[model samples]
Target: MSADAVRYLVMPNPYLSDGVLDVRAVQPADIEAIRQWRNAQMDVLRQTAPISPEQQERYFAEHVWPQITSLEPSQVLVALERAGVLIGYGGLVHISWSNRRAEVSFLLTPELEKNTDELIALFSRFLDLMKQLAFEDLGLRRLCTETFEHRTRHVATLEASGFRCEGRLREHVLIDGKPTDSFTHGLLAVEWKNGQ
Candidate 1:
């Protein structure tokens, strides 16, 4: 769909916290940190190259800021923070308002990936909050994610959060000059409500 055609209902309040991690709207100050993290984790992301400061600035001004201000946005990006420090960022991207569905996109500071236990804890908690935002606050019926098959730990976390494996795309993407398979996962509001 054309960028201009996408619509989203404005969230009354985009801040969410569980007495620890806080998920709030992405702001100007977050773009640089987000760019760095995305660049460092390109192997696990769809982005092929590092984002330039200029490009990041333009993106925030043209695409992201509009979403923050618009009543209807194509995406809902947020900054993940802990004790007022930025840890990561992500949100419901590729949202289809009519279908009430969106793709889950999340990432953390590159350093955190080195610690398995902390990674799982933060990721799992983040997923929980995203679920609340997607299925509860936004009234979306479905949420989905695409993960590279090699990310076993990440995939396990998704499954633990109630997302079921919908399918796997064989050799779906190129990673380090080799074909890599990706798994698609989905979670419905009904299923989430039932604790499935």
Candidate 2:
């Protein structure tokens, strides 16, 4: 399908904590915000790779926008907004209808880390939303994610939200030119529903 021709199949937005955050499809204006968030990651062990405005615009106009527009019937790209500010984002990617599986990734603004509870709540909402789409809408049986070892906080959030660590990939990626390990996690749709 032509990239631009792919139509977005919208799903109901899901919010975990009452009156805390609102998550839904990505909009045109969200592109700049996302770029800024990614670029803002430049401290401690985690670094936000810089993205110039021109590059950001190109990415949005070329990749992200069209990907969301042509998202598979089973996939979704969501942005989390709090008090009218874009605070985080999560999405189901690489959807495989035949395998009934997808990978998920997310990021939160640096400022939100101090409020751990709220961050967890946002992740919970995203996972639940993915569960609904996988089982109810697409009838998928599995959802998966991978995280770096240093991101212990994110792993904790995922576990608290019901996903379990299944295995680890040693030297998964070269970060700062050094090999790093990654943990693979997954939650079955049935398991998610039962946990609720």
Tens-digit lDDT track of model 1 for 57-146: 998888877776565578998888999899999988999999999999989998988788988898899999989988888899999999
Which pairs clash in the backbone of model 2?
Answer: 41-48
The TM-score leader among the candidates is 1
Runs of candidate 1 exceeding 4 Å displacement: 1-9
TM-score for all models, in order of appearance:
0.93, 0.79
Q: Model 1 — TM-score against the truth?
A: 0.93
Stretches of candidate 2 off by over 4 Å are 1-7, 10-19, 42-49, 67-75
